[model samples]
Target: MMIPRMLRCSVLLFLILAVTSCVHTPPLYVNLSQHNPIIDDYKALTNAGLAQRCCPEFPLKDGWLGGDGDVSVPLDATTTLFLFSDSYVGQQNQTKRNVPGTKIIANTVAIQSCKWEDESEINYFWNRMYTSNPRPVFEPKKHGNKFWVNDAFLLEGKLYVLLEEIGEKENAAPDDVFNFTQVGYTMAKIDNPYDTPLTWNIDYLPLPGFQHPQTGISCLTRHKEYVYFFINNNDRVQQLVRKAVTDFEDMDHGFEYFARDRSWQSGIETADMDTLFTGFRCTTVKYHSAVKKWVMIKDIQFKTNEIKMRCSPELTGPWSEERVVYTIPETTPGNEHYHENNFCYLPRECTQNYNSKSCEMVMTYDVNNFDLSYVINHELIYTPRVITIYLPVEESGGPEE
Candidate 1:
């Protein structure tokens, strides 16, 4: 049968559409193994070298703190680490005395150095906080001279630092400890952080609603309109996720809880957290543009705790269930301790110039001298090892595949 030209064209189009509908997009199987980390422990600093001894001159009568506590934010081409340390009074079999509040010792290092071996090259922007806060600020006599700053971020080229302050009491009983812990915010402008100004635009905000008061432990990152804070609420599950609605640079805006009505564990997974729905931090690179995915690393605590990672298509996720990407070596007694670990992605070329689907990650976390105390005690601490994990080259799609 001879068909009209228009009718024949229509029939051919229909057949083509039918075949296209049946074809499935090939899954993107990224070969993560091909990419290797630049090296392990590019710049390793131990407590023995960084820790300051307990002395009467300092706030703590007999105490020490390891400078491992830092929050880093990437600026221009370098990563600025806001170093935080606190001194404690109680040392050995004795009642606790007054301690130094969180004091800031500012420093900046190129993110690239994080992949190389040069400790001396790194610059410490010390007493930079004193410059950030130009006001002749002095702690009230009751609280003593102590400040605890943790978890810092940079937004719009301005440094946003968060800290907690503890207060003391006078004419009070020996056993009576005044419960005074407040979260404060401060800002600094790094025209050239190498030549860091000696003052900051400092301010304090009240710490609210807690069975046990906590401190910020890790770097906070921006996801869309929200800033995510990773904290330890002084409980079994030491790490808790919190959020602030405004941009980190805006001091006027206060933080609102993620899911006001729900509890931590149950509420987060179920999407009850908030309207700005997303979860991240704990892992180094939360938002990776190459893969178009958000990676979340959770620290689970039991008798012996471990770290794990999960991925989602978007920052606000219906997250893929966590996979045990790596486990801390249980070779020694109680190897897994605190929740602090590191994760960083290899540059794109390392993945052979692959697109988002062909991306790869290379991460390193220090297991030796896992904490500041390792230095304070003057102990030959564990040699924190850096472990690199390569995700398989197959696309991770749909949970439990």
Candidate 2:
């Protein structure tokens, strides 16, 4: 959906003013460690050409294979699986358009395998098992319309996915076809997701006490015996809620939300949910062992180009102020190609060097402007951009040389 120009401009101006006025002060976590955080530049995943065999049109003319919903699952020390949400096959123009007669090939969920050759290089390969008509795995139909996977992860050897049900309303405008409703989560038992031509035994589960008109889990993570889910309410604010690990299969009565006082309360409505972060849509949270902290990466709600990072000593705790780790120059709100949107998100399992004193986190994100009109006239900028972030070790000495 295209953001209104007036609103976009206002946000851009506000961010610019905010950045310019900041003093040359140290990072918020400077007290935890004297060494500065090392953040690398954005690296575009170029190995997408390997996936062309499944869908020749991949990396669609101007667009890329998938949009949003990026969650990386580590298969081993060097191999990882990247799962995409609402993935599609075909030219970018045809797949993203809502006009009449446009061909839409919905892949539902797409998988890509990545192998790390070294610290700075990765090779990508497509998994054909996920590229099927209607995508045989985990397809939910509601009132004759099919739902798509929004996000997924492997927990205790089972694949858990959040599904969204969406379709064009009768006689709706061309731009309204993509409107969707959060349909909740589903679980599937799979021996190995990386294996080609895989089979899945899927089960749908209801999110009791948390279901509402425009609310759904944006991202999830497990700490100790609890699974934390970041709930998004369509509005900018995100709430943190958790459920007992033992009751994961018993969805009906396991959820408890974190309240303003930092205490867990039973029932969603009874809990005074605290806002985790503002101006965030797609989000991810992971626990880092090296620093004994929880790290989060998410795109600023309206300002997609800016990816913010935050850290906390505990899962449900006093988080540090957000720091703008990376900004996509191409999507700068007032730039030539200002309409483009970008996001940087990481899965809970993708960190390879957690034991190292310096934490190195690897993740992928999408970069593309969703405006249909912009794509037709200009080349599409839709693709997943990979990046690595290094968090300095917590040492008593001054900044690491």
- For candidate 1, lDDT tens digit of each residue in 1-401? 11222311110111110000011122232222232221111111111111121100111111222232333333322122333333221222222222234222222211211211222122222332223231112121233444444444454434444444444444666544233444442333332332322333444443333222333333345665556554434422223344544443444344444453434332222123333222322434255433346665554333233456666675434566656555544322443433333221210101111113212232323222333443334321221122333333234331111
lDDT string, candidate 2, 1-401, tens digits: 21222311111112221111111211121111221211210111222222121111123322223444455544333333445554433332343443333322332333322222222222222223223323424455555454554555556555566555545456656675235445455443343444432333457775545553445666677666777777776656778888886767777786788888877888675336887666555467766544456777665544456666777887666676776655555567676545544322332224432223223344455555556445333433444554444443343221111
Model 2 lDDT at residue 96 = 46
For model 2, the run of ten residues with the poorest summed lDDT: 17-26
Question: lDDT of all the models against the reference?
Answer: 0.32, 0.46
- Write down the TM-score of every candidate: 0.47, 0.66
TM-score for candidate 2: 0.66
The number of residue pairs in model 1 that clash at the backbone is 16
- Model 2 alpha-carbon miss at residue 122, Å: 10
- Over 4 Å off, model 2: 1-67, 90-136, 143-148, 167-172, 176-178, 183-197, 212-215, 275-282, 333-359, 371-380, 392-401
